[model samples]
Target: MSEGEYRVAVRALCDFTAREGDLDHRFTPAPSAREGIAGHALVAGRRGEGYEAELPLSGRFAGLVVGGRADGYDPAANRLEEVKTHRGDLSRMAANQRALHWAQVRVYGALLCAERGLEGVTLALVYLEITTGRETLLTERASAAELTAFFEAQCRRFLAWAGQEAEHRLRRDAALRELAFPHAAFRPGQRELAEGVYKAAATGRCLLSQAPTGIGKTLGTLFPMLAAMPRRGLDRLAFLTMKTPGRRLALDTLAV
Candidate 1:
């Protein structure tokens, strides 16, 4: 599983259900493991299937397999999801080592592709505990050739544990278990500002926002600004206020 081979069961469920020929979008855990992760993919929207999952290694190797599991997998969409229990906050991961976190899902994707003899696979890392009441999902793609190359490299480097994959998985797991939300719930109007900032950043548009006297304007402005700032090239982000009080307050908020 070269990099992130953690989602084998998802592919299996999709495979099994498809073989059943029911177009059974339902995901079911393989009668595979004794215990571990347990969730199913949403599958094909209304045609979705659900399932429980095991984390055991197939065709057996020497030691216990370190990481890999999918609570559920949706074949139609080629998506594999791993469920995590955490004090949810997606941005906390933005500063995380990207290669490592992405490796697991990419590897898992490779595994899924191998299982179904597929040419492509999609991986989703979902966190259910987010403050926004939304799951944090990260997606990636794996082509068969890519998966094969990755899996072969993983097998070669994995046992010796010389690659970034294992490290990436560990960091991701830790962040999920221990990382706190970088910012709390959006201020009363922060969500709107954040959305606007996100759109502006996404499309390279300019933005102008005003905060009257006392709302938490700094966060209201900066939170989304930070989130979208990276999406754009980030030449520089300036908060200019003519009023001493407003500028003082904005500068003070930046300390957070």
Candidate 2:
């Protein structure tokens, strides 16, 4: 959230750099988001009293802030787990998906070792079947140095992209701060609408405004929003419309 600092979740970092091969969803229907959450809870409930569930882990690599909650950890065993929910045969899961799962858990392993000051730790992947309540666990032992090396490798691959993105945001924010209205003057009621939008954005409030046709509502609204973006530290702006013509109108307004 600061200058030169790029934040990313642990799973996101692995997905961007560790994934390989085609993305195939044909093996089985994926579990719903709600089901996945419940499955994780069920797995956590089955653990021993010494088990810690939803363990928050974080580490920094260069300018990137990486953080996520590991699914479970057992201090007694010095083990960290990453739980995944699935509905079908585990053998049928795609190889790339499995590889990505290992990549994520290994990163968690590196973080856990660093946090606990361990020379090595056991990394686990716990797969739970939603309907059957079946659990399959795969685990491996990794030295802190090895896991750290892997973690740093992934981060090194991602830092270049993060740097480019940071630079783009800097340039964009600078440009947006100097944005101006496209036309020489606002139509009747347009200036009021623009003022309302600018105030709402600057103060982090929601706004609703109505203006008659030909009041130049699109430009009036968009220009103020862009002008307010840098002041409010907004990362992105989106314009949503209900129909094709509305989309085209907004696009044309942006073009201006």
Candidate 3:
């Protein structure tokens, strides 16, 4: 592992690597966000006292940190489940969708097994139909080795991107930490505006500075923002402008 590493959630991993073809909303048939939360609660309530809901699980794969919450788990039964709430016929779901769901649970199974020091585990996908109030389950038993392999395969798919992201973040942080004011001296009002921006960024707040045009506003804003980026742990900086001329001026100042 390098000094800097990429962290990813299990859901993100499945969403990033397991997805295929165009995004199709028709086969999903998932419930609304609010309804989905309620559905999960209802299902958790129905389970036995041994049932664990919203179980947090995490594991490290290569240089990436993968973590997420499992919907339900039963230690005594050695079962880990991913609950999905839907509104329509699940049979209409795309093969890739089902594969993606299974991939997520399998990774969760691996995480649980590693965390609990188990040799094997059961992976289950519990689908609830909102309209019919029916539950359908698909279960698979996987040995620890199989689960680990599945987790590694998924991580391997994202390893290149994760590495690049980590490298970019490192370079950005290094540059930000060493950045200095561009010009020899700040304009009359530029110092105040730049100071406000730096303080706002450092404290994680918003800043609205009102200044007349052509007072070195662009360089003043950019200098302090770049200088504060490392301190604030910012991943990206966006300078939004209203006009094409403003964009050109901002870029031109940056070139200085």
Which candidate should be chosen as best, given lDDT against the real structure?
Answer: 2
* lDDT score of residue 228 within candidate 2: 93
What's each prediction's TM-score?
0.38, 0.96, 0.84
Report the lDDT tens digits of candidate 1 across residue range 1-256.
4333432332342232223223332223212222212222222232355432432223212331333564557655766665543343445533233333455555566666666678776766665442233455667776878855755554444344423545765554554345332575765776776677778877987877786655666767665665554345353578777889888787777666
Q: In angstroms, give how far residue 90 of model 2 lies from its true place.
A: 1.2
Q: Order candidates by TM-score, high to low.
A: 2, 3, 1
Question: What TM-score, to 2 decimals, does candidate 1 have?
Answer: 0.38
For each candidate in the order shown, give its overall lDDT on alpha carbons.
Answer: 0.51, 0.90, 0.86
lDDT of 3 by residue, 188-216 (tens): 99898989988999999998888997788
RMSD of 3: 3.0
**Over 4 Å off, model 3:** 1-4, 23-29, 177-186, 203-206, 216-218, 239-256
Model 3: ten consecutive residues of lowest lDDT = 21-30
Residue clash pairs of candidate 2: none
Top candidate by TM-score: 2
- The runs of at least 3 residues in candidate 1 whose Cα sits more than 4 Å from the true structure, single-residue gaps closed, are 1-47, 50-68, 94-98, 130-132, 161-256
1 or 2, greater by lDDT: 2
Q: Candidate 1 lDDT (Cα, whole model)?
A: 0.51
Instruction: Judge candidate 3 against the unseen true structure and give its global Cα lDDT, from 0 to 1.
Output: 0.86
